[model samples]
Target chain A: MTEKKKTTIVLFSGDYDKAMAAYIIANGAAAYDHEVTIFHTFWGLNALRKDQQVPVKKGFLEKMFGKMMPRGADKMGISKMNFAGMGPKMIKHVINKHNAMTLPQLIDMAQELEVNLVACTMTMDLLGLQQEELLEKIEYAGVAAYLGEAEDGNVNLFI
Target chain B: MTEKKKTTIVLFSGDYDKAMAAYIIANGAAAYDHEVTIFHTFWGLNALRKDQQVPVKKGFLEKMFGKMMPRGADKMGISKMNFAGMGPKMIKHVINKHNAMTLPQLIDMAQELEVNLVACTMTMDLLGLQQEELLEKIEYAGVAAYLGEAEDGNVNLFI
Candidate 1:
């Protein structure tokens, strides 16, 4: 038997459209029976945040950054045409009309499909995101861990 | 003799930061003797625009889009923290201070280093961009062209 095919995606964008693209690709790859891994770092970490507060501890700057950033995929702004948040609201309306999954729902689907979600520990540290502030049931690792998986993967993507 | 490792980057963002990342990765791969192709599409096509106005005929919507969109790498705004375009200006100042190459300069270096640059034909057709409006010496192709190159590529990224 041949070795299992793998696809690893490094998600580095916090923009709604970009995060949607990454999840769409990840879901598609998983459907094709590929071992999929999504490594979230920096702004991408915002996707893993819970919409409701989790009561985590943070310094002044960290709290400021956390408050300024969108809480979850649902709150993400479009990279362009944001129009002070109207773009995302319009996008959500469109998605609802099309009966398509929201970013948060896609994240759920990815989990149900067993896609490996890896959080970048270094970024979490830098951004002051604690484990309590993020969604549970995800892997926490560094760039080396991602590189090791990427080395032998048949397909590696950085988004 | 060793097989050539191929890397294909699908540049899909118009933001300065994303464009910078794509070119930096392409240059790095080229430095490592890897065959690199940057398939620029949609918003990413902004990076390929010439600084000077090319005076191409366009439809009303296309003309409006052309007028609204930033021209060339130097005019691109940051994906975030744009703050009415001050973010990119600050970034430019920082790059200048570090003596780092600007986006336009990076594009020139990519050309000199022999990195294959392909603009998406469909996007151009949809956006009403003519060949005369863009820089010379780059390939214009469709998704099939990108897929053909990506099929054999060990690393394929959608940025």
Candidate 2:
């Protein structure tokens, strides 16, 4: 039997458009029958955060970070032409107009396609995010785990 | 003889810090005897712009884009905490204090180490950048060329 082709993506940006691109690529790879993994790191973790607030213990800096960052993918802003949150609204409008999926819907589709969604543990700790605050069934790991998957990956992207 | 590992990077950000990360990885891969290529696209093309202004004919929108974007790596802003350009100054200060190489110097070293630097031709046209406005001795190609290099690469990243 042939081994599966691997596609590993390191999602490092928190921007809504960038996250959408990452998920779009991840879902596409999964659809092509590749073993796909999306490792969420740094601000990218915000995409995995639950929409509602979760009660959790944290230090001053962590709490400050939590308060400062968008709670979920829906709250994240676009990377360009943000125009004080207007860009995201406009993008959502376009998505709806074209019958394209939003970032949240893309994430759901990625899950449905059985794409591996991993949160970088070190960054999550630094950002003061706990497991309870993220979506269910996602894996937690570090750079080493990412390197392991990417070293043998057919498509390794740091987005 | 065994083949050398390959690393391909898609640089899509205009931020100084992100560009630095991309160059650092590219330099590291070259040092390790890997075939490395950095394909600069979209806003990332700003990093390749000549610091001096080149008189080039352009349409109204292209001229506006040229006026708005940074002229070169030295003029680019940080991804976060840009505080009216103070952040880049602080970063340059810290880089000096730590005896680290600056972005321009890193690019110079990448060239010295024979790391391939490619500017995406499609984006260059879209952004109104001519070959004369970019650095000398670099390549220009589109997404197909990037995919060709990346499909067999060991470490592929988009930043």
DockQ per candidate: 0.21, 0.26
Residue A57 lDDT, candidate 2, scale 0-100: 88
The model with the greatest lDDT is 2
> How high is each candidate's TM-score?
0.63, 0.63
| Consecutive 10-residue window with the lowest summed lDDT within model 1 chain B | B143-152
Question: What would the per-residue lDDT of candidate 2 be over residues B1-159, giving only the tens digit for each residue?
Answer: 999888899999999878986887788778778899999999999999999999988899998999999999999997864545567886677567546778999899999999999999999988889999999989989999999998888998889
True contacts kept of 2: 0.50
DockQ winner among the candidates? 2
Poorest lDDT segment (10 consecutive residues) of candidate 2 chain A: A59-68
lDDT of each residue in B10-127, candidate 1, tens digit only: 8989989889999999998999988999998767888999888998777665675577667888898887887775899999999999999889988999998899999987666655
